[model samples]
Target chain A: MAEGQFCNKSTVNTEEGIRHLLSDTNGKTYYKEMEALEVDSAAIQATFSKTLKSRLKTWLEICTHCGLCADSCFYYLANEKAPNQVPSYKIQSTLGELVKRKGKVDAKFMMDAMDTAWSKCTCCNRCSQYCPFGIDMGIMFGYLRGILYSQGFVPWEMKIGAGMHRVYQAQMDITSEDWVDTVEWMEEETEEEYLGLKIPIDKENADIIYTVNAREPKHYPEDIAEAAALFHITGEDWTVPSVGWEETSIAMFAGDWEACKIQVESVYDAMERLKPKRMVVTECGHAYRATVTEGPYWAGLKDGKTPVESIHYVEWVAEVLRNGKLKLDPTKKIKEPVTYQDSCNYIRNAGLSNDARYIMSMIAEDFREMKPSKEHNFCCGGGGGLNGIGRYRKQRDAGLAVKHKQIMDTGAKLVISPCHNCWDAIRDLEEVYEDGIRWSFLKPILLKMAIIPEHMIPKDE
Target chain B: MLYDYVTGPIALISLVIFFVGITARVVLYIRGLDWRLDRVTYTVNVKYGIKGALRSLFFWMMPYGTRSWRVKPIVTFFVFALHIGVLFTPIFLSAHNIILKEKFNFSFFTIPDALADILTIIVIVSAVVLLIRRLVLPEVRNITDFKDYMMIAITIAPFLTGFLAYHQAGDSQFWTIVHIISGEIMLVAIPFTKLSHFVMFFCTRVQIGMDYGIKRGGMKKGYSGQNW
Candidate 1:
């Protein structure tokens, strides 16, 4: 089991213990799938042809192996400084070896490569922030995943999620009808609290086409209601489309460019049909990044211009607050000291750190900053679709040790994370570390603090 | 006669290789420019990108931008000092300028002999510190390969020989010839080894800042307090 080999007893579960838990489960299928894949040089070269570029080449060539990036990785810190967990080592062993071998490798090497690329590294890009060379390891790992994905070697969870997106147009496989019903249900639920609240659906030419993660509909319907309530009070013209409504992209995480293209194309098509001036994505980090940053290129847009402007909901809300569209009641602030967990995509990828912090300061009465907040903040160990992969639960949990210590040092009662994956990972950490800290999305906190005008209040209320 | 050949023909060949090889690499990178259209969907703010690129170039020149400074402040200081020393010594040192004046018929700048000596000492001492760290630190040592050590030796040779020649410590003429030869070797090796980072560092940083800083909205006027 190698108990306490990688991490302290408090944070790390024994490998043997994890194996025991997975003995009867489908976790064993992942390794079997890796072993079963028919990998060859041609396929490997084809993958590289699709993924490789000058930037990646420069990164591979210029990395000095300064080891500065080691401290930036949560897995490295959590795993008692395992050298293999170092970001450069991960790239060196997998991509480095592949390049060294000229794309000729055996199945055992592929197995090791897959584990290193998919399981160990989360593609969070925190190391890039620390890298003196400015090498984005996250993008590098994404390319590695793309190569592995071409070989049909991916975690089962990712495969299922990508399939669900292809078939059902949502990561959770929620049907269009179910999506509509869920929004309608959320409207009804919110109506009970604030009368005359409506979740406008399929409205054309709206100022904003608001989209949400499939998890909002399938699991956390309250988040939908919370967002709806905020929009209702703020008097913003927003609508949710039934088709292409789910913004999360499992295809992007799985590195299936075709599937990723389909997911993004659907959303862009929806936006084009609805003719929204802008699209506001809910608190899903990867979804927002995939749509706003990477979607245009995936869709083959020449100039990197989308049909419609896109903004993360955090940025949208902050803009709305700055524009005086909605007033926040200082008296209704959260009494407990709170800290914000900067999502890697939102902060590092999108530069929304200040916007999120600006919103939090307006809402939280006592806001304490994490020691290393914003772009430098450690990943919550759930990025790169690792949260969805059930086979790596123990590894992901142990990886939370670095984040756990960061949160504990803040001495805050509540941690507000703006991204779905960050929220889920932090919640898992709460359970794993038994840290009695509560977690909430920024939407709920915003809804709690926004002062509703008397005229906007329901007549019944 | 051997010293003259090493200082004249070999040195000239090394310079030719250095410039030609570096120019080729740069040309290749230019041809391979990744429009980065995948990650940036809007009209790139070139003005902001250039500004951010310049800012990042200067920011990382010091040790303040990374957290490793906190863990190994001494190493950080030495590394930073070494960079400063190596970059300035060749360009501004009076001895190098005398040679430049004779060969190229022009000299742009010259530092005092004492200052040049001090900078040379900084380079030599920092090289030692870096080498020791590479050997001692498991994290650093694991990544350290033969080429890494070779590059370090190649880099140190010129500075060490130059310092010895300047001081006329032992066989001053012999040391001077060794310094010129070693310096020539380094010039030839720069574009071929990890030393290429010396030329590509700014290009890479500029791309990073342009993509991340301008496109991703981190391009604030000053250090945005984000790690970058």
Candidate 2:
């Protein structure tokens, strides 16, 4: 409630929010990428050169280092006392050096600045919380990262994260065929539990359009099965797109604004084309946050363009429970105590704090709160592509100590995190932080644990 | 001695400036119109609410908690020397004493006879050092905006007038008047301009004290110098 404090902690507190929101406008090369098939090599290089010079100049002139920005950074806190890691100080070292040198600085400076701007930062906006001056140092660094990204100066591992967005629009790189096959396969598997329940694909006039993060199709396909199972038990008339239903947007995180636009556009265009009554995004935090809160603004699609109603999975599940579409036995309970891990994007970014709790109450009996839970939740160490970098293991673990402590204090046998990044990040913390807690996504856990009355199960046979 | 005639106008301007300047500075602080020290470091409250605005306003007033104390060595030393000279010279000096008495009926604070002369000399020298540093240092040079360059210029004008008025060398009264008026103009501008960085500087140090002394936390923790 402090004057500068924001309810959207994920954007204002996390490195990705700091980097992505501020740096959203950085990808000027997106135009070039679109023209890459036609433009000559020299011209492309020249444009890049001009973009770098102009962006760097703007970066240098704007910043006045007051050091207030360093206070809230998780990385800054985790690293003991290093001045250079502070957002303002970090900008001063790289962009500041370039300004001081007037572009006379060599490639070595570029390389060094690139390393600090991209690899060292999680692009979380937590530092922005402490800055009294309203300097979006994360945005400044994000722009610089965009320029470096254009130059192929990013760490290779980070490239995979970006490339996943580039090739598949999701971090796990699921293809259209992969998505269809995966959903169809999961729907068939669910038939044993619900007779001939359907995972409707691209159904016209359906009440809701559903999207899943690529990670589900690629790795945790069973989680999608659980979601499908929930839909079947509720008899919800929802349809998943044959394609463009992948909701992860790494382009936003990587500072590639054009790619961000494209990824978001893919979904929006799909919405317009499909005209589903409402869209339900799966539990991936960033994608859901971006589609509803940020994508509309960033893509120049303001209040009018896509008012197709958007809801997160938590909201959808709560709707089913409230509507009595699904019969959930309140007497049904999990064997052990369970607690909810509020995804930063869900609680802070999308205002889903109550939604997660509401959904949790329907499924789990012993739901306990983590201290400073909901909007004030700490990021899972791997949320913002930190898990992608092999070298960041120590730093990631160190930054996650606060989260580990929160989880340990909960003393719950199960942790239900709704976001894939939280899922992976907490799983890593389980191994590294030694909490030894079993975890599952909220929707999946609910589907598996909740007792569905026989009347709710589809009589497809 | 005849310089008193010219200095009379400058002294009158200085007096007017003092009244108007203090009033304006206080008004801005009370209204929270001035930019906050935390804006650069914290998440600026972009939404509507009294709580967010007031929180920002509170920290803006007492920024000692947010700003850094590790002033660049040259910057710190010269700034300190200059502030002492500037703050003391106008109030304590005999030449100005005559004008204040004639104009507003005010006089020196303490040890005026000795301290006035010493403070005047320090003020003049420090102002010159500041001008030179602004031009010479690259990092400082990059950060210094046009207003910064002009601050040094404005600062020097008053001191020069005072110095000239002291020696009774040139239009002493006029120089004295110019010095007093310019000094007063600056006092009024202090709260509004980046010069209010003084407010932030003090607040930053205070915050460090509270954070370390009361919170009992390591005050200087941070990450490696990575860009993103």
Candidate 3:
């Protein structure tokens, strides 16, 4: 077993990262945008105040503080089982602050509490699973963040996520033109491999609507290329909506509940308009978890029933593999030690962690387990809009010791984290804590292993 | 003999307090249920079907006189013993039991000599342990409201009186009178007091579960699970 004593690093390199995160005039304009959109600030405040009572009541009532909750917390486990890192303490600190002030605390308290609540605890809900009394601190924090967002006390970086959601109803802030251009670019790149394959956009009566995370278009176009290649090889009937295809809803992360509800609703509306048989979320844990699980009802999708079916990318990939649509040359992708980091939103929330591992095994020859895998996976310490807030670097790095050690223990040079936030958060952890573990999406690895028959090299030479 | 137990003032006060307490609790429970169920938003997930809802409801009913096999039998019995003894002892028996017998010729079940004595001891001991647990455990301590202590005190009074009256120990009848008055006070206090948690728990759980289940894919098969 790996070991480490608890260390609290409070010194934030504020000047370095905080400059990038300062909310500009454009950011402040979101309040106006919301007002223009008829969002009632006073109504929202009242709703938040009401929510605070239930949230506080739940906080005060549910926990029996058995401390068994601490044993399974990745943060606590990493910190030599320190009492402070215990999952309950995070809730206790904020709830105590709220009670002490009777919800009349100043903005400074909001900033401090939001950072501690959001940056420190990933919304993995792993502690909820392990708690003897089933206290859902993650959900509680989600509400706390929501209340904070209503008050406009949101940290700078998280505002971007909500801004993206407000602007495009997506996470990555990829504009409509950018999405079309990215798809066209990827389609061109993949056509060289598929001869004359086309990635359809807004095609009516398609069997499925393939949605991609904003990261694929915003930063990692190759990830989208792999998705195109897989679909091209499979000959599956899929379409990407030019209007509403960006899948990740950072509004959900920013604790902008109304914004999140709208974003989720837009996806449903797109699905209904296209009348697709199903919706396939490309390699995003939170996107899939929210769309298929939490977001639908929150958006009032329960009047009748949800329109289109939804499945995670792992499930789709496994289906494609089973159907003999994709062939793989595992040897090409098997060079170094490889391990899978289960995304919490997918593993615990969506139950796709094993499906991801099963997919990983097909491509990586050196696939190994990260001890406590699947539903029990640790958070990457970058959830709940932590990465969005540049002010949280110190706590993010220091609090993520559990995930850092888990990655280190696997001794794997390559770690495949399927979710975009995990990739960002884990990569940030590597840089800040100097715990180097090469991280990439599983899609890229699968691309290296995948072989289209037409592109296959001849055996005779 | 009848006059020996309940004089005019005890009967009048006991009946009035008991009626008012029961009415208030029922009203609060109904109102709280309406408000909680009418809530527009909920976050928890409940997957079990109507079968599950009934299971949860019926299981909770065990301490209220309905029993179920699925819940923890021993724990349920202990809890049931505590609840029933608290509810029935002063209001229905011992003090009020004596008052009705002496004044109105209305008698409920008299606790048998053996069971009564055994249960009286258990009730007092369990109340002390529960109070100590509330005080000692940090999690429990953190959430404990002031009303919780009062409820515990109200619950334990009858058992304490029964203990004193068992041996006719030291003006035991006067102590029994004190127990009857306190029990009546609790009934009047129950609806307005946090003791309504007794009824609120089921409604809230059901509401939370339904909200969660409908949000999760279990409610709608082909609907896009997206939250909007």
Candidate 4:
């Protein structure tokens, strides 16, 4: 075969999609920023040396080019075997090129590298599982992101989000006052639906310090209301923090370690002051991973020495159900056949598959299992901050075809994803494809199905 | 004189280079370890990590454990057989054992001559199949380079020449000399080229298991229950 002739004729014309991306205003902004960024070889080398680990070196050396990992990549499968989109090819072209050049490449090369590292791949890590040697493509891409981030080549949306986190300590720039106001508003809204429901803010010594994605307040305030109703119904002492309320970490996704560190530290600082037994993060995949799995390290807290335990909201909900503290009303369960979208960070990264499934089973009348579910599930094409990066929407939408087919094959009326990013991406797919399928977060379904005992009900109601 | 040079001094030098080079490479790899002091700990179950490493080693050895076995069974079989032959034949072949016994008075378990012949044929055939694959498959061919082809040739030479010498199909002395020289070249090349995989494979697998098994706490009851 001719060189660079690796893509089959059947492959989707990704060039057109890329063209669409470049035509967008956000994409133009991203291009302009990348153009303005100075290409310094010394800086690139420093960042690479800093991020390149022994494990990554072994991974680079040991690949036999078996092409088996291609089967695991949704881009390869969905794009009709586009060789460039293959996981190995993606890594080899970007990281491999970087290593070969010793970080002395130019702007055009860095742009191509950024395209492959950021826009094309989602860093979901399914390829790592299929790799016989277990080369983690996700971690490798993360390191690549770090290198690019150090060079100031981050996408505009990611940069904005990270900047927001650095300034306001929350994604979407939700200030401390706005955060408290949203909580109070949700508390009142939830009180009208469920008597005596209160979305506590900055409650000291609470059992759980609840945190949420900023999207919960900005776009989907009902999620906050639903979570509040669940807490009130269960008679649990869970308080939303006035500060560090947003659990989502665009900084981590943007590969800004300093910003990521600050974002994680803010949450821990709030938890430390609140003295909560545990910090229960709302259903946001990257947020849970950032705070619970990666937070302590970023915050300079030693392993096993975190000030408080961090748990995903799904885990907390599952625990509540297991402890019999919350009862599910089967009669009030979601009547539609629902399927669960396993968020990559949650299932693959955090090993919370069982809890997610259990929560779905408890709330939904019929939970349809998508093919290749759980940790092996394909990304919603919005992972690794791709959903936040509007510049790559066309590529993101094209990749969503794989997820659309998976969801369609399940024949479920509603697909429930606990992750805000997955929910957003899947919702986009729903609209774009006109699939006539609704999507939701786990909080709404749980609130609707959970039964509160008569004694727990407010006396006035 | 040729035989003595090929089998004696050359052999010793190759062995020295192989051992020292591998040791140095391994040391370099260890020294290069980032240790990721800044990484947070989800869990530190070293026991599970050990178990997971052993499990991965075994799982990957069997073709059934990988998805490739189903998708590309022919290639998978050839690759698997190639690894078995290349790894086992060197230690177990009667001739190699005899040489070891003569040189260092070291001999281990020996495979029957018939089994050795079968393994030799498998190795030779698998090498050819792998070469054809490198030449034929578009994606694989794209990555294939002179070094890849040279590695295959280096691997195949000893077995091919050994088979010819054993059967006396060619001049026995010539075949034996070629075989000894080829074997020496392979030994010396192991630490320098793609052949390093013979040593690094275990290290890489174990490190992966440690990361996913111990740090991630995903390994449960000998199976990584994360996916299922």
Each candidate's interface RMSD (Å, one decimal) is 2.9, 13.1, 8.5, 3.2
The numbered model that scores best in lDDT is 1
Leading candidate by DockQ: 1
> Which has the better DockQ: candidate 2, or candidate 3?
3
As for DockQ, the candidate ahead, 2 or 4, is 4
* Model 2, position B24: C-alpha lDDT score: 60
Q: Which 10-residue window of candidate 2 chain A scores lowest in summed lDDT?
A: A1-10
Residue A213 lDDT (model 2): 82
In model 2 chain B, which range of ten residues has the least summed lDDT? B219-228
User: Residue A67 CA error for candidate 3 (Å)?
Assistant: 7.7
Superposed by TM-score, candidate 3 places the C-alpha of residue A363 at a distance from the truth, in angstroms, of: 6.7
Estimate, for each residue in A264-309, the C-alpha lDDT of model 3 and write its tens digit: 7878878878889988888777787666666655666544234677
Q: Which ten residues in a row have the lowest lDDT in candidate 3 chain A?
A: A1-10
**Which segments of model 3 are wrong by more than 4 Å?**
A1-45, A48-105, A120-137, A289-294, A297-299, A304-306, A321-342, A351-378, A404-416, A429-440, A448-461, B1-171, B181-195, B217-228
DockQ of each: 0.47, 0.06, 0.10, 0.44
The best candidate by TM-score is 1
lDDT of 1 by residue, A70-90 (tens): 888889899999877788888
Total clashing pairs for each candidate:
1, 45, 16, 0
Candidates 1 and 3 compared: the better one by TM-score is 1
What do the candidate models score in CA lDDT, each in turn?
A: 0.79, 0.59, 0.62, 0.77
Q: What ranges in model 1 sit over 4 Å off?
A: A1-27, A49-51, A455-461, B36-44, B63-72, B219-227
